[model samples]
Target: MSLPKELEVLQNFFVKQPNPLLGVETIQVLLFREILDFTVLRTEDTRELNTVITPLSTENDENVQRVAFLGSKQKAVESRQMERLLRTAANEADYPIEECYLKDYLCLECPRCALYGGTNASASKTTNANIKHRVAYSTAFSLAAFEQIQQTTTFNGISDLTVQTGQTLNERISVKPATIFPSIVTLHSVTWKELILMMKIILSSHKYGAESRIGGDVRNTVVGITGGWEEFITPLEFTMELNSEKEKSLSAENVTKILNKYKLLLANQKKSVILSPEQVDDMLKFISGFEIDKKFLTKAYEDVRAYRDVQENSKAKKK
Candidate 1:
């Protein structure tokens, strides 16, 4: 079946090359400002401390793992959101539910689940058949370390009734009104349509992180795509330079300038295209009417079939 016009356009752009093996590589830098006070605990000696959360230096080995974890979690959420949108569109179009919505238990049967990976408890199977992800993040060190960003204090468990008791039962900590971080997400072997959808979810979504209760909205996001890995800026180098310049009292405006400079540099050095949030929104709007195509369903079917065959072969070998 033919895809939506918007999706078709993206697919053509992403798979322009003769070989589909070559997929688009994107580096997305997101600047997040905490709309509400939130806390990210620092653990030491198996105990949680209320120390101020700071950005991890690129030199630290743990930084990669932490950034990757954040990126992976974000991707999972974005994929789920995409699935919901698709399912709703299919329903509105009066498409067969079975053709569009895969049962939760039959995760392998769903295109989104297959791309994001899923576990089938009933079948006792897990499938990891999606694009590879390499990610790294840097703290808004310049703003945080220099205290240029506005921060406020809030007392937890400080209800009026609780305060009535003579004993103080509330704890207070500093929370920033906004936090900015630089992140790079690399996708391998993913289709253009999927990439565009993921980008839409990232840019359009307001909710993020563990602090969703208050509000961890992603305020500004910029994405740049490069044909080769060498074209992207290393997260560590970028963060370190920004942090080093903190002593200069860099304003948010100045920080953005620096980021823009780097983005331009990458564009000049490689075949790169920068996508603004507006562009992503436009694409999503254009594709809102589109439903899942037969191509996607066929791919999911093949993936499920291959997985079951492998499982059966393993069981037979055990016997």
Candidate 2:
């Protein structure tokens, strides 16, 4: 009912390395009802729930029907006493044992939709949604009893704890990294562009490494759509163009084409400024063009633009 005095208790609670598996948490519950009462305790076991729960086709059924219990794993760490108590509870509650698990935390099959009856859109992928929802729901319940303190605590509340659609849990959860002492932090809004851009940067940074990129395909697709200009060009090619001494000798048609390409891919509200073909080209050229400081120029362009805008705003205010 109350939060543990020690935060270590909370961490240890989740990092449950018991006899069988690693990273498991156990919860014991004593349920009380009108006439019949029972108790049950279930431990979080690291049995992988990787089953894909999708709609099943029933004969001429317009309502999307699902196989309620397909590929369900019975690999829970339940004590004999806990099992007995749960059995008693199921009988008294007049619900099937399966149903109880489905409703409770034991249901790893599907995600707990907090906004099921409210506003959140229907989850696109059941497995992915379940994983996210499970983490969020468990986290919410785990921190439920923590009294909300001001700036120092609580992430300001539940809303602050949320990862926007494209944002990551690790990034959103802590206002700042726990290691960072005393800094202002903003909870970032999740955007598809942010996710795509982050993925591209990551992949580009480490594609040479042995570690497989998780979201490379999505990132590529996004680049193709957003950076319509330089999709076919490799980073190497882009570098060449950026550093080419022949740009001055090139025809006006070619110059116009290059500039137009950049304009097309620049950041817009419809989408985040992804690595457009033009920027990719620009970056490549920057890398290749030893004549000019490509990185410096790009960064300087951004800095100058921001400074000029700020100055303009100041002047306008004065006026």
Global lDDT of each model? 0.43, 0.23
What's model 2's lDDT at 113?
21
Task: Give the best candidate by TM-score.
Answer: 1
Per-residue error (Å), model 2, residue 276: 13
lDDT string for model 2 (17-72, tens) is 11111122321110001101111111224322111222221122222211111101
Clashes of 1: 3
For candidate 1, give the lDDT of residue 228: 32
lDDT of 1 by residue, 1-319 (tens): 3344544323423432112134444434333333333433222343232233434443333322122114444554466676775566456655443332333443444445544554544342445333222222333332344244333444444458766435455442333445554444444444454554455555555555544565455543543333333334554444554555342323444444445566666634444444444544455466453334644444434544554465556667788
Query: For each candidate, what TM-score against the reference?
Result: 0.55, 0.16
For model 1, the superposed segments whose C-alpha errors exceed 4 Å read: 1-69, 96-106, 119-143, 146-166, 170-175, 229-231, 241-319
Which consecutive 10 residues in model 1 have the weakest lDDT in total?
60-69
